[model samples]
Target: MSASAPICLERGDIQGGILRAYGKRGYPRARFLLFHVARAEAGRWFLEQLRPRVTPALDWAEGGESVKPGQMTRPEVTLNLAFTFRGLEALGVPLRTLKGFPEAFADGMAQRDAVLGDDVGPNRIRFWDPVWHGEPGRAGVHVLVMLNALIAAPDVMTARLAKVTAEVVGLAGETAGGVMLLEGHRGADPRWQELAALWGPQPDGRMGPLASEHFGFNDAIGDPVFDGQYPDGAERDKCRGQGAVDGCGNWRPLATGEFILGWPDESQEVAGAPMPLDFSRNGTFFAYRKLHQDLASWDVWIESRALMLKEVWGLASLAEARATLKAKMAGRWEDGVPLVKAPTFADWQAARARMAEMTRAEQTAFLTEFGYASDREGRMCPKTAHIRRANTRDALDPLWDAKDGKGRLGSALNNRRRILRRGLPYGGRDDPDGEHGIVLLAYCADLFRQFEFVQQQWMNHGLDFDAGNDGCPIVGAHREGARFVIASSDPAKPPFVAGGLKPFVTTRGGDYFFQPSMTALRMIGQGLVDPT
Candidate 1:
């Protein structure tokens, strides 16, 4: 039951032995690698099937115990299998590209050293890299598989199907990858079925949408237009600014965008040899967002507020009022799209271009130039602007920083904490109540370090390394009438202030998982999950 036991079995002596065996055979090229992890019964069945072809690397003392710590009983069975397309082809087993997890565990141990506190232990720290046998590649293995069922099975037979599939797929030789069983959710569960009915079929075979539609969990934002744009780019601009449009006649938004699969090309030959098995072949990553409609109506809110501001400041035109409001809020516009970048008030294209130029470091510099330093002052990005909070791009403290003496800049925080921000607007643009919002789908490697940390700590709590100031100005939720302030460009000048901006988007449901390689799949299929 000790953590080390599983580590020893999977990554230690047994794994090393197998890798050696495979290496002795000239490290055969793998055509496709199949990965699967099943329950104990499934694992047993798979092992039984592979027993004749592959030798088990079990130790008497470790084989009979549970892999998890503190458990006296053995795992009903643990099945980790990988199948090599090349090996399968050689054996006359025709195999095609199967589904894969985008975020599978590597062979290395848990990230014990990276985490904080004494809660870190053998079980907590990963001793092996999930990709010990391979390299990191872009294959939408995690969310994609969950969004769609990779395998096809009847409602009543899913559990059994997964079990049998695990065994059949396991039984490849060394050089084959291992299978990884994502921890949460069962393929056969009713909840999954309902979700699938609403979504669509998974890439592999199960029925479900490529993405989930339900949004009623923690901090969940409602369904949003995947990549919708309002008619008359001008109207879109107005809406982004005033949160409303009066003159536009055919204003509407689009839904979703083209789907891109992450499969490797099979036709291309490599150095006179066939291509490697496309483990992540035929899978796609669908970005789902929970947008807040009311927040997006900020343009209208600003316009209404502008009328009042005009009365207060004696402004004659709406344009003047809008400028004054921007000054008061310490920024150019509501979308966090600064007017300084697009001073001419160009279209969204101009705004997007400006945004693209502003990298994390550039953004930090720009905000800091306006007298808001992310390193010391949280007011600039509010300690929580999606960019400032997520990973902070090496702005974290030394303890959290990956390198010493270089402060935050020395670390490659970008790699582990990058988020693919696939955001889309939601709700009808015509709705006057400002009910339309944006759905933000962010893909990151580590949820705790990248996503959750930003939400709970920097974005929500305003607690960065320095820990000063409130949460993000645009996104942070606060009490009514509370002033959200940001410093002006002039340090000598007073700060700008905005009030009554409500919380927009919230977190819904999300899970963490690993994406393994196709070669790893073959390891699982062969019941040689133990690489040690």
Candidate 2:
């Protein structure tokens, strides 16, 4: 039997931070801290100690008890705790329990990304510069703590996180039995006055530091919303903008199971979960990755490519050509306007201004509301556009032609591949260590069919997408014979084929993690598991 909606979701039981879009809350500061447990007993005790602190997915729930005259809840801080397969064993979880986890999770990130073609080369994790020299390289990271807070008050949040880390570290007393801290964002936050003083500042080019992303594009246009969850009806408007709708002629949020584990997916099947439904019920797997973006090379290539396109298409100037090409490559203009909605360069700029003027409520309606159904010819938005490739939405049929591909199954095919991204772009592309990229936190019920499939088939391969061996233009692996084709609106104009692309986004270090339910975590803390 399949669950229809997330009517039964317990805000207190699920970790909200995993699903919550912290960026909207203006929580510009975040830290992804890694840890290695040295002793079983100490690890177990630490797990027990940390249970009360795990941030639940229910933070958005309305109506809270009022604080007393002398009692005030601290301004909320979002944190989630999850562990790797090795961390599970380190906590003395029975081998039986550990053995039942999804094979993708069991294999860990390094080995699995190899199969998914994540551009991992010989030096292994050293492919990423930050992981190459830092403590993260020298040690194995078994636990991850996703720490986040608003940028308005950084010192307070930083101190709170530091204290939380100190308390957990103090439990083991020494490195032999305690956990070793693998600080990923060392002195990264501008508010850490003391640390910034001692280590100097690490300027991030993403918004709040500068104003937009390093590529000069406005990032994270919007995301999917679920039905019956948002009483505010904000999701309904956003879904309309993202062109998300079910087959019922109904516009609604995505099916709950598309993201949260244990819910019936769009097909009404419970995704593969670990032993003990309670443990995996509210939990989901995360594909944590550090992606490095090379801006210097990209800037040069984009400028050169734009000039070439202007004469071929008879465009106004290099600047107009650049905007059109940028929109074509990214599926949206820098202003978060999708190309399918606004095809021309002028339309995008006008829409960008329109978006700025739209009341917050109006902006929601302006999002993903337009699909490629109108432009079946791939003229308005090419089938190979980066955003189109990432989330095919209603355009799945184009990806699978009967001639050499699976017959039209774009709708059903895309339903199973959906994932809720809980990621934030880290460091500026111009950062000294080349650490400028996104810390991707992918949330989904199944790792293999969702994250891996998208990363491999859709993002890296072109056969299924019908582009003939050309992969994603922006972030796909620069593989052998890799290319991207930009279809021209004027049939008289020849198509532009971009070839011999270099690897733009490089994987630093990563891990596969299972973020358990509050109950499952308590069970782990108490060492109460069937493991059978």
Off by over 4 Å in 2: 1-6, 60-76, 119-124, 129-138, 153-165, 168-176, 183-212, 227-238, 241-249, 397-410
Q: In candidate 1, where is summed lDDT lowest over 10 consecutive residues?
A: 1-10
Which sections of candidate 1 miss by over 4 Å? 1-292, 295-301, 304-417, 423-427, 430-441, 465-469, 477-482, 490-494, 520-528
Q: What are the candidates' C-alpha RMSDs?
A: 20.1, 5.4
**TM, every model:** 0.37, 0.85
TM-score computed on alpha carbons, candidate 1: 0.37
What TM-score does structure 2 among the candidates reach?
Answer: 0.85
Question: Tens digits of per-residue lDDT for model 2 on 87-124?
Answer: 88887777777877889898887776566666433224
Question: What local lDDT score does residue 360 receive in model 1, on the 0 to 100 scale?
Answer: 64
